[model samples]
Target chain A: MMNRDELRTALIEEITRVAPDLSADEITEEASLRDDYDLDSMDSFNLASAIHKRLGVNIPETDFARLQSLAQLMTYLEKHPA
Target chain B: MSDFLMPSLGADMDEAVLVEWQVKAGDAVHRGDVIAVVETAKGAIEVEVFEEGVVEELYVPVDTTVPVGSPIARLATQASVTPASHTPAEPEAAPNASVEADWQPEPSARPALEVSARTEKNDRISQTPTTPPERLKASPLARQRAARTGQSLADVTGSGPQGAILAGDLTSAAPQAPAAAEPKGKKSHAGFNPAEMRKAIAAAMARSKREIPHYYLATAVDMLTATHWLEAYNADQPPEKRLLMSALIFKAVAKVLRDFPEMNGYFQEGTYQPSPSVNLGIAINLRSAGLITPALMDADKLDLAQLMTNLQDLTRRARQGGLRSSEMTRGTITITALGERGVDSVYGVIYPPQVAILGFGKVSSRPWAIGDALAARPVMQATLAADHRVSDGHRGGLFLDRINQTLQDPEQLNQPAHQESES
Candidate 1:
């Protein structure tokens, strides 16, 4: 089982690891990772790898399409526990 | 005894400053052991010694700039009697293995003899020689590992002689969590000046355009089938495991390269040598300035999933300035994709020695004609820039057509690849 704050912190850490250009504060919960960080598909894939490495969850490609923001990723992680 | 010469990293590289020695006198080193670190136009490269032996003497000291192919150190090779008798504990089979090794002349062997007018002449006109600067004593591999882990060497206390940094020092210096958080600020300490990188790129591209007789070709490919296949394939998987359009493109290019060997190797000294393996050079743009195209080794043999993983790793390492000496030089054919940036098409200049470069544009929907009907379909432009000396327009066109055909049947990309990809 996962909580909201834990998931958010993990996602933020993963994002920061993949795209060092973006700060933790800049990656708002509501803003899309692509829009805010210029996270193209490659960057998105890297983020996914980071998440998999950290949380031990394989985020499906379909689920990736739905995850536009940090909030969505956090929610998805909460629902699909590692 | 054999001379360990300074290796020429690329056609554009003429000289490099010997940064530090990873090995010392009386150190028992193997064939592939990294003996020294040298700072080239590209960056810090841990130069490997190809011959197994003990160091007899280091001809040139650290912080001295030397010409390419100049003898940097002398190795008392196993071929010699005294060294072989002295190193009796070493694996006997390892010494004799070179006798059974492939007869093909090593490209790096005798760099002085192999220096051609094209590259050596290019180096004279374009090379910007820099005086050796005082650098932190660390192996190139250590530096790369440090960068990858988001740990900086600035604060780490070295364990090697004279407090020289080593890879082992990085792990204990900083814990992973807090160090990862501070990745951004520490990257600037890499000491990579964007201006120097720009000049290096300029020299390489200038030499490429001037020396290599390049012919360009482009084909508009329909991506509807591949798109649908990707969607269906990824529907069941998590976001982390999804396949992108670029991965498909890379797979297609790698597969097509197998059929057309002429477009997949280095053209050195007016001779076109075909490589047995398809080591795809992926052009990754650094955030600072210019780009570094590191090879995705044995790409043709990797399945689609493996390709994605390797590409991600290669790009991450490239951007971070953590590439190794071999990855920086061993590219057969290059693939440059501008699709993610929404560019319509990219016509790239062929990196010298490599005969060809494959380019991919953005994947977007456009009205396309199919027989008697017209429909809005996903289309992307694939471009090829090839050396005219090795391949004609027909061969280049066929290569592009093969890639398009492969992508049309994207299912093959996921299939188990041929086991043997090497010569």
Candidate 2:
């Protein structure tokens, strides 16, 4: 199972890769992904691919659709703990 | 009369549901006319008539599903009719007759025919109990080549002993020669690849940015009224029938597009070619496949219930990679919403030939000036990308204005309250 802190760090790192202008400080555990960082659909897809490659976790399309904020995504990752 | 077998829609489709019967028994169906609607993994697709004739039989009923390649209906020709004896053994006769006809070619035309005949005679002798061939059998290459081409081993000629077939003889005797002109060094660069997907994105985005001059217009619409309306509506609705904000947006978009037909077209051949019907393509992200845009046909004609059904069907098939070729084709406009994804604003690229693409961002709590006071309200962001070639900036602005107006007022959307309640 992935640890919460590690998962959060990985998520931040992945997000930063797509949006190079975005910094790690911009994304927090509880912050809204869309409001805090302008991650659109393509960015979300890229992040999902990055997570799959790094964490070996399969996020189904439905789950990806439901993920809204950093907190929600973290909770989802835990439930589907990889 | 000859039976007309169902044409395979594609290599992937295994079975198709007979959604509707376009021609009843005894009705004449012309070639290329839609005879029935088949519901495959893709969507409800219309099957066209291949042969023109009177519909003699309805083997499959409406809503009844049949396997692909199975005869769903039969056509009557001028030929004499035979009793319905569609047995497993029937298919064999057709293939055998064709095979026999295929074999009746001029002997002199084929140089290796005499050698093949001699080899077959030798093989028959060697197989007999009285005598055995000195050699163990055929070469590995010859056997592999024969298997690959579906050629009979006995039919191959031999350059060897008392007429023993060798690999070279078999290769020469092969009726169809593999094309040597085909460039073997070059790899197959066709079909779907990652580079292609990226290129498609690049092309679409480039076209959207350059030709379809887009103007960004953001509006803060109060969802509280819509929220209250939804809550009251959902209380009476079954859990399954409950309307999502996405559905409301879809209905609003449909209604708005009906008013402005120009927005429901593509900029083709230096002119705006408006479509007769409104087919909306929704972009869905799949895990395995990067992203897919599956279309919902006749969105303007569908009721709320039918729209919901179509949405569910499109999304389901999209994820399964079972979308039909037609579903991805002929989309007049596109609507993409990151409703639950929680994005505040997204500037979407116009899907080509399409005049506009509507993008919906997530609803979030933001401070708003309500009358004279500041208040926190749930508001969403919408961006419309319009084809500058067909529509001017003023017309695009007007279209967006209509969409915003419709979405803000829930009562306007729920015009037929009686119909909603009955459902």
Candidate 3:
């Protein structure tokens, strides 16, 4: 099982990688996905696709927007372990 | 002594009205401190002090619509010196103009100082021109990659004759763009136009191809179970709350990254800097602009409802060209889906920092042996492009296996009872 902190950190690292402009400090639990990061619909799909390929978990669109922060994402993943 | 000029805040506003002054004559002010409030087309914004010194004079009155580049205030050093003559110079110049004039010293002395500075700056510029070596021309993308990484043209050994830079030169050089160009959205380039956005895609992809050491792996998985699960779930949910295949893929990817931490970091400073959160970036294909990858922060944390909302919001904004700078940064991995348009399999290029990229291709019906009879099933092909520097082909294959395993088992992805009850 993936630890919460490790999962959070991995997510942040991937975010910084794909979006080179964002720093780790900027990604917080309260950060809004669309408002803070400017991710568009297609970008979100691409993000999901990338994660699916790398991490092996499927994130349903029904759960996409609800994930606002690293902490929140961890809870969702724990409930729906791949 | 120097004059502080009111900066042109925007292109539309020709003049700014001074709202208030936060400093007074003789008061010590530091650079970056709020010195005054100026009203522009957008709204009132605080202007910061650009230099540290005592406030010597206030040139513009509050509420005055001062033209852009006009001096709003003056700063004085501890040593007393006569204020240089303004002499109807450029209208309303910054205090720096006077300092520049005073510092000119004499015409005879100016040449020696200028010559030295010029030589130093020229030396640096000559070291790295925009042009790439001969072989790099073969791949326009390679030349662009060299330019973006700020590799000293002189330092890169060209495989082609005439000591020209090549696509191979990028192997040893760092993948950082030269500081010479301001980051995205700050300035327009001759070759790349921000208005079209394709320039960004081309630049990023070129850089990724040239700089990232990529190793690709592919996997084909049965999508029938997941497809059935999604259809059943959507039937009971509202249209707005319906889950998308992309979201499901993202959730699975996020979970897997936790197990293989190496893929979720950037190779920097001779080491991989692991990130603290999982912010996924999605690649969007804008018809006019080739492609743009905007980020979704903390994809693992959102519920189905929130995911749908966020996805909808991001897509809406992306189509309208409303993305911000922050959205473009810090993605650990990338996922691309060809949806109905893609072929059965695709091997993506590895996006830097993050060691891998996943490509999801179109789902198709294929024959499979179930017991003794032949069965046709709908399946999708997934490809992984990983950075060879961090992960080998074996590990990359294993990562794909994990994703395929999760995707094949649809019942395991049932929404939690608590989550269902809350909804």
Best by TM-score: 1
**lDDT for residue B250 in candidate 3, whole number 0-100:** 70
- The true-versus-predicted C-alpha distance at residue A30 of model 2, in Å, is 16
- Ranked by TM-score, top first: 1, 2, 3
- Per-model CA lDDT versus the true structure: 0.68, 0.57, 0.56
Model 3 / residue B212 / CA error / Å: 1.6
> TM-score for all predictions?
0.72, 0.49, 0.47
| Interface RMSD to the true structure, each candidate | 6.8, 20.7, 10.6
Q: Which ten residues in a row have the lowest lDDT in candidate 1 chain B?
A: B87-96
- In candidate 2, the residue pairs with backbone N, CA or C atoms under 3 Å apart (3 or more residues apart, or in different chains) clash, namely B42-B324, B158-B165, B266-B353
Task: Give interface RMSD (Å), model 3.
Answer: 10.6
Model 2: per-residue lDDT, tens digit, B250-328? 8788777877888886564466767666778787653212455667876766666677757766664554223443455
TM-score of 3: 0.47
Off by over 4 Å in 1: A1-8, A25-32, A75-82, B15-21, B37-43, B57-67, B80-191, B236-242, B419-423
lDDT of 1 by residue, A1-82 (tens): 6689878888887786676544455578999787656687778877887787778888777666689998888888888888
Pick the DockQ winner: 1
Better candidate number, 2 or 3, judged by TM-score? 2
Please give, for residues B1-423, the per-residue lDDT of candidate 1 as tens digits: 666666666545666666567788788787557777665545556676656678877777765777765677767676533322322111111111222111111324443332222122122221342332234444333455565776655556554434445443554454463323334322312223244456767777887888789999999999999999999988766655677788888888887788899998877656777877778888876542346787898788888888887888777666544455556667888888888778989999988778899899998999999999999999999999999999999999998998899899988678866542442
lDDT, candidate 3, B194-312, per-residue tens: 22233334544666677678888888888888888887776565434567777777767766676776777666434665555566667665432245555676665665556656766
